[model samples]
Structure formats: structure tokens, C-alpha cells
Target: MSANADRDDRDLEADPASSTSGPVGVPVDAVCVGCGRTRVTRTSLEAMEIDPRVDLSDLDAADCTSFKHVCRSCWAITWRNPIAILTGLLESERGE
Candidate 1:
């Protein structure tokens, strides 16, 4: 009957797909259409070292650019393009 318990119940009801005990499942900032994870981005997808033909086709480019949710788990597992990472790092270093 406490306020905290009431909130917990509400939270549970709000998102049935979320795991009760696992990685901190932050609410989807951007849902990835590929794996249905709430954590993906076009840039992140592009940075993945997948065959451009296979991977790019899987991307929901319209949604990603519109600032929607995506699959963080997929992104996490995908091999990242080192050149992209290095370029990003260099860009930051240069304050570009």
C-alpha cells in the first residue's frame, strides 16, 4: 500500500516485455527494428562491421533518422568498424 509499491506495480504493468532481473533494461531510447531492442541507432548500425549489403538493408533508416528506438543488444553484439570508431574518436579530439 506504500507509494513505492504502487509505483513498482505501475512500472511492471507499463512494460511487460522488460526483464525483472537482468541487465539494467533502460526504457528504449530508440527501438531497433532488427532485433526489437530499444537501443539502436543508424550511426551505431553503420559502425557495425557487417557486410554493407546485408547490414545496411536491415536498417530502418527512416525511423532511425527520425529519432526513434532501436535494438541496443544487436548493436552491442555486432562487430564494430574500427575505422569508424577511430574516426569518431579523432573527430572528438579535434572538436569538429
Candidate 2:
């Protein structure tokens, strides 16, 4: 197996959160760090690539850790034209 794959396997084995049952001892209402979306359980947030090491015990509904939550339309637009979005943001910033 490739190095990265091997490493991932090791990490999976070592991390309790990566287990099939999901993160043990973690809160159920943790917010996703990527999309700022609240996941009622670790399994729900697992789909967002959240690091298992991040603390979720004191997570609040209003906290946005990483601006991770984007509506489907916004995600689609971003995937379709990242450059266009950046250009628009730059233009707006420059008042042009």
C-alpha cells in the first residue's frame, strides 16, 4: 500500500473517533468546523472531514469555527467557478 494509505490506516486504528461506532466520549451536538453546521452526533460531522482531535464538549450553536457551512447552492457555485467568485470578491473590495 502507498505511504499515505498506510498512514491513514494507522490513524484510523488509533483514533477512536474513526471507529464504526463514531467518536467515543464526544458531545452529540458538536458543530462542524468546516461548514459551521451543527451535527447532532459525531457520525454526522464525520462526513465533513472534521479532525477527531478537535474539542466538541463545549461547542455552542452560535459558534462558527471555520465558516464550514455553505448551503447547497453556494457549494455548487463555488465548485463551478472558484475563480469567478474570487474575482468578484476582489472587485467588490476594490470598489470597481
Candidate 3:
């Protein structure tokens, strides 16, 4: 009945995946696809010893490389060979 409650209802309906607790509904801290390292929100990317120079645009909306979650190390490696990775993703989408 209240405005806040109405908003909550709308949000729940809009995103069925939302949750009040845990990693299921929230943005995860940075994850390294290369080493399978999961960083929580408290740790800075630099503190994780991740490369700051790596461009993260190749990572898709889900914060993944080629739609697959990768760590900073793996991202660094993949970034070095962008053409191959992009071509592979495109090819995969084409079922080639």
C-alpha cells in the first residue's frame, strides 16, 4: 500500500533473479578467470595484484571473457591476443 512497498513489489517483478542475501542477487567482486580467484568487495583490484593495464572491455556484460568468467591474469593473456579471441567468439556464435 505504501510507496516503498509498491517499489519493492515492482523491483521483485522486474528482476526475478534479485535476492535479499548472498551472491545470487548481487554483483560479485572481481573474479579472475585465469586463476579462478574470487575477490570480495573489500579488496581493491590492485591489492589483488591484478594488472591495471588490462583493458576490460572484452569482458561482456556479465563481467566475463567471451561470456565465460575469467580472472585478471587470464584476461591479461587474452587481451594480448585480442584478434584471436574476438574471432573465436564470433565464430562460436556462428556455430563454426
Candidate 4:
């Protein structure tokens, strides 16, 4: 089932990132760092290649994090375009 992104991670009773549902149903701990929304769903590393906006080619396979979360707003507005989100991530990474 599609998760409700509006829910707070702190209140979740299960580990949403886990493949199997936890004690309190899938625990929702993933909140979008971009929008502070809980709408981000974890995507496998293999799935990243399918997304045109994401570029993992430069990074080593072992160094790359297995999970990627693109929030609704980012996916729709910034991430869908690639360059926009890349700039955003770069700026954020630079502590700007």
C-alpha cells in the first residue's frame, strides 16, 4: 500500500524502511529532508537508474547508498528535472 506521507516518523510504531511490516505496521521513519514531509518512500539502488533525474553512474557501487527517497514535491517539481534537484543537493551539501 502507498504510505501516508503526512504521518510523523516519531509516532510510527514500525520500521517503514524494512521489507516486512513491523509490530505497528510499517514504521514510518523516513521524512523528506527536503520538505520535512513524511511522503518519501525508499527506492532500491537498482531503481535509481530508472529515474532520469538520478545519476549514480559516477559513484562506486559499494559507496552508493542503497536507498533513495524523493519526496512528492521534489519528485514533481525539482527531482523530475534532474538539474534543479542536483543544484539543490549541491547547495545543501555545501552548507549554503
Candidate 5:
């Protein structure tokens, strides 16, 4: 292929409509209450848009200092052993 042909094939401007490719300016924090672990990541705006159907009562936390984020790994572990996770949480709270 000629140089001109290659230049023509290349894109001059990025598609702003593309949500997948761009600077990850949006921040997302996921916290696991049981182990007290936090996972912070930057993603696209579209990825974090709130869904009306989802009840975000936690968003209105009175103190505004609460643990509502949970990493995917922790969620998976909870699904596999919910009783163990819940028990551990309770034990930690009781200092037992």
C-alpha cells in the first residue's frame, strides 16, 4: 500500500461517542465491610450512571461516611459462603 493509502486508512479523530475508549476520569470505590478492604478504580461516566430502579438508600447515608462498596471478588466469595462471611463480620463487631 502507498503512504497516502495508509494515511487515509488511519482515523484523524477519536469518536467521542465511544464510551469504552477514553480517559478514565470517573472514580469508583468498592469497599468490603467484612475484611475492611477498598478497591478504587477509574472508569467511564456511562459505566457509573445511576439506575433509577436500583434503591440507593446508602447514597443518602446520614453521616455520609459509610461502607457501601464491595469488590467483585468479595461478592463472589460471599455468594459461595454467605454464612461464614456474615459470621466473621459479626465476630469482628463484637471484638470476639
Candidate 6:
């Protein structure tokens, strides 16, 4: 089953990303850094290949960090309150 992107990661009892599979289910394309789910937009993945965030480039081994991308759900949240998202990222880097 596809994940409910609206759900908070903290509240998830089980990894929704793993819900699908084991016989018959949609294949997981890629995981989301923001939501930890396999739900993602083709456009966003394409965008990542085309132009990633400049600020995220210096992040150690960006391929592992994936700080440049967010899920469609988190993208919506980011657009609504980018300050919050940026602040959270900064705080995490600060070990806060």
C-alpha cells in the first residue's frame, strides 16, 4: 500500500514504506528524506537530477544525506513554511 504522507514519522507504529510487497504491491521507486516513505514524484526526481539545491551541495557526501530533496507531501509543507523546514535542518546540523 502507498504511504499516507500526511502521517508524522514519529507517530508511525510501523514503517509504511514497507507496507507494499511480499507477493503483490507497487514497487518502491525511491525513499523520501522528509517523510521516510517511498512515495515520490517523478518530476521531483527529475528536478534533482537537473538542478539540486546549492546549499545542499556542500553537505558531506550529498548522495547519502539527500538533503536536497523532500517528498511531495513535505514539499507542500515546505512551501507553506519554508522557514520551519530550514530551521529544522539547521538545528539538526547543530546537533540540537
Badly placed stretches (over 4 Å) of model 3 are: 15-68, 75-96
Error of 3 at 27 (Å): 17
Alpha carbon lDDT of residue 31, candidate 5? 49
Model 2 residue 67 distance off true place after TM-score fit, in angstroms:
14
Predicted candidate 5 versus true structure: per-residue lDDT over 57-88, tens digit per residue: 33221222232333565663321111111223
Any idea what lDDT model 2 has?
0.37
Count clashes in each candidate, considering only residues at least 3 apart in sequence or on different chains. Answer: 9, 4, 5, 3, 1, 0
List, residue by residue over 25-81, the lDDT tens digit for candidate 4.
211234444665544243333433433234433433333332344566666432211
lDDT of 1 by residue, 1-96 (tens): 699999998998867554422223111134444565443223433233233333222433332223333335664443221211223333454484
lDDT of 3 by residue, 25-58 (tens): 1132444445655543222223223343434334
Clashing pairs in 1: 30-69, 30-70, 31-69, 31-70, 32-70, 32-71, 39-70, 39-72, 40-70
What TM-score do all the candidates reach, one by one? 0.18, 0.21, 0.20, 0.23, 0.31, 0.22
Ranking by TM-score: 5, 4, 6, 2, 3, 1
Off by over 4 Å in 1: 17-96
Q: Measured by TM-score, how close is model 2 to the native structure?
A: 0.21
Measured by TM-score, the strongest candidate is 5
Which segments of model 2 are wrong by more than 4 Å?
1-42, 63-96
lDDT of every predicted structure (CA atoms): 0.37, 0.37, 0.37, 0.37, 0.37, 0.34
Candidate 4, residue 53: Cα displacement in angstroms equals 30
lDDT head-to-head 4 vs 6, winner: 4
List of clashing residue pairs for candidate 4: 14-27, 15-27, 16-27
Task: State in Å the error of residue 87, model 6.
Answer: 36
- Taking all chains together, the TM-score of candidate 6 against the true structure is 0.22
Worst 10 residues of 6 by lDDT: 78-87
